[model samples]
Target: MRVRDVRAYPHRVTAQLFSLEALGWDDSWRELASAYDGCGDPGRIVRVDRGLFGVATREGLVRASLGGAVLDALAKDAGAAPCTGDWCVVREWCDGPVTVEAVLPRRTAVTRAEAGGTSRGQVLAANIDVAAVVVALHPEPRLARVERLLAIAWASGARPMVVLTKADLVMDADLIAEDVRVVAPGVEVICCSTVSRRGIERLGAMSGEGRTIGLLGASGHGKSSLVNALAGAEVLAVERIRADGKGRHTSVRRELVLTPGGGSVIDTPGLRGVGLQQAETGLSSAFPDIVALAQQCHFADCGHEDEPRCAVLEAVGEGRLAVRRLDSWRALRREAASMGTRSAARRRRALGKRPRRLATRQRETRRGVGR
Candidate 1:
């Protein structure tokens, strides 16, 4: 199957397919194309269910599994594991089973730290251009949560936008917008209502041709409803929130869908918790005001905790800066730093074990030679 044939699918469906740009196909894909000339099939992973994957190819959709070779690659670097929106090469067995051979590179990846206090990062979606952080107005919103998500999104090398969901439930949108502004200053915020179609057009316009946007938020935030409304079809399954106004994980996995206007949207299951790992750069970008203030502090290493002449503390005391915002920034920075240290230690330990294994391998090789 060829790329041209794959493009013949319906425009809406084809938009969800991986493109060479998204796959980082400048020179590496060319190399893979040459190497796998007649040995494998190329496709993009559209959905992942349990251990099985639904891939879109020139011939259509096919279920695929990771072959031994691919699994070995994944073991070497879990980051290389096949993820939704990844372009891969596969070999079709005589029995009609498809095995993933290789995963193409990604231009942009949206990642977050693994939940449950793990230091490892988990890739949510790959090759994304926009990371839309959705927040609902029904539950009165949580600005701290939005800030955390914005930090992760910014760190993922994707443009971050805040989508205020269930806007129809709020009588005073200005108050909600004001609350979000404190946490996500300088970021674009769009109030969208699936019931009223508010800001849907703007949401559609943000996704342009050849661009992929990722939708992220807690469950019951109306993410699936918004996607379905924007797609102009019920392509995704919708679920009702529980009595506590929480989501039921209607969208179980990450899958890309094309908007009726243009571009693509990657909808994912509601996240229970978002952890930060190696997100220092993202934090700095997300809290630029705090970073800027720190530069003017009396001491270079000021912790802003009862430190004399601390600009951040002084600003908070003077009511110029919200204390909650500062606290959130500090908490995230500490968490990210701690996770980074743990991750570094794990890498060092792994590297330390390699030499011992290599020495054992060499001893065995020498014994075999003597025999």
Candidate 2:
């Protein structure tokens, strides 16, 4: 965007405005901001309160609402919605508060199924570079959850990293991280202790300048702690969990927290319903080994179950792949596929037409879901 457009409405500038770079402002954003031609300021959303948003810009932090133009875009695609970590144009707007004219193109986005089984995708964060899947070591890492999260991270078009947190509370942190690493084909697995500060620097180094990392995990996974450790301050609050080891939801919404250094980190509340969207490419990335092995199956469309010369089954038999990992991968694949089926059905319903194979394919989807 043009410098004048970014500085639009110069009277609105305030001390609360944070450095643009800290919020991931760069040349790419300048180009998008230029579209406004001195009508609005380029801003990154830090928090969304109620239906309004709190954006950080060269003019400082301003509370804004979505304009009609962007709202129309959201009607067509959920990805176009203004989400935390999104860089948007904050217009002086018409009669009300400063409005977000439009959301610039996002390089990466983290999306999950909208809760309530609506088949709608809910974007958690946008324009992130790295996705840090934090798993605490105290209760042991759940590979199934890791695999599930990895699928989302992979689908976001960001580099996925597995961080095993609270390492000081566990005896086999490294071993557990290794187990997680087995499922993380091209991902990095780091065992970290927010208390002991283990792997803190390495994780901090992952963020700086224009780079933005997204932290995602279940509640009590120490996502807040890791963010605090990385920022060297208590930016996000944390809560003590129950004696039974279950964690209470602390963060109520997704927020973008800028590190003291540079770059930004988007923290999302614990996800109880971590559903995968149309993430076929994500499944392949998360389970590259399994996808590669499946390529060698005797049949071109082998399901890897009771099929002759099933490379996947043979690998499991030879202990080349963990049965549990493979199971989790299959589960995610099935869940993703089933979700796609449902999504397609919903789209067809919206169009007021029924496909000939809809019911048959749905039955098959149900039968294959738990297999």
Candidate 3:
């Protein structure tokens, strides 16, 4: 954390001396990297800015540009672009320019639908083990936002953990954490305060030794503070909450920082909207209590809305489940379903256009033959 500590063991603070194994590489990555044997070194994307990438390889950190193949993949699907926490192949040319040749397969990716009404999903961070959803306790926590973030975390194929930050600012932190546990169902919930250093060690342990944890939440949630606390230094800038209790966006980009214990943490900018895109399993995972109750419904397709002998509604009636929770589930379900419909329509439209495109290509081929 001190200047001497950073200077004494420079590799510990920087992206140097991190072997492939330390970066969570495995047999799968080894096999995948085999095809690119003569291409370049395998690296992990530590940051992505504009169209450039900061890749961490065995040699250390290097700024690189996207290669032609990677750019083409991005043109087809934005999600295919390299994101923080992604393992990629980096190549340096004799002309003094480094480029990302290809991105390896991702084990897990935190994704959400694009903000501007697009059915396509955007990859936030890839290859994360734990998705920490930070919720501030100062201005009253929003359970709805917690549920939405938990759903996204579940869909990412990572273990979701609810971190109640700013606990020092609130008196009833434990009580609020219990309530959040109810909504998160099977997810782990812990309350911590960077101001008082409460529960920081336990949260920090999740990123220990070859593990990767991603911080996902809105602004003013103390995510950057947590990263600084865990790293034992001011690795990132922090901002105070506005006078109106609104959050100020401090993290402008997604960056993967290597902590002291050979672990990594990916910090992302505040997400304004996390639109659900085909996250059915995630919704079920986020609301397991409701899913379990729905299993006993008399009708297999019961909508839980004014349906006869609906177990879900019955639970709500008997005070077994909260009405607002069910309403939140319904809203997320509808949003995911709506996005699914739109995504399917778009796929069908693309399929319909494919034949015409092929025909056009065939005509061009014949014209070239004639020429």
Which candidate comes out best when scored by lDDT? 3
Residue 192's C-alpha lDDT in candidate 2?
91
Model 1, range 237-298, lDDT digits (tens) per residue?
Answer: 88854676544677888887766555678888888888885598789889999989999999
TM-score of every model? 0.84, 0.88, 0.90
Off by over 4 Å in 2: 1-14, 93-96, 241-244, 353-371
| lDDT tens readout by residue for model 2, 130-231 | 999988887877789889999999999989998888999988888888778877888899989888899998888888887888999998888988888888
lDDT of each: 0.79, 0.84, 0.87
Candidate 1 ranges beyond 4 A from true positions: 1-41, 93-95, 241-246, 351-371
Query: Model 3 TM-score?
Result: 0.90
Where does candidate 3 clash, by residue pair?
none
lDDT measured at residue 230 in model 1 versus the true structure, 0 to 100 = 79
Ranking by lDDT: 3, 2, 1
Clashing pairs in 2: 1-30, 1-31, 1-33, 1-34, 2-34, 5-38, 17-60
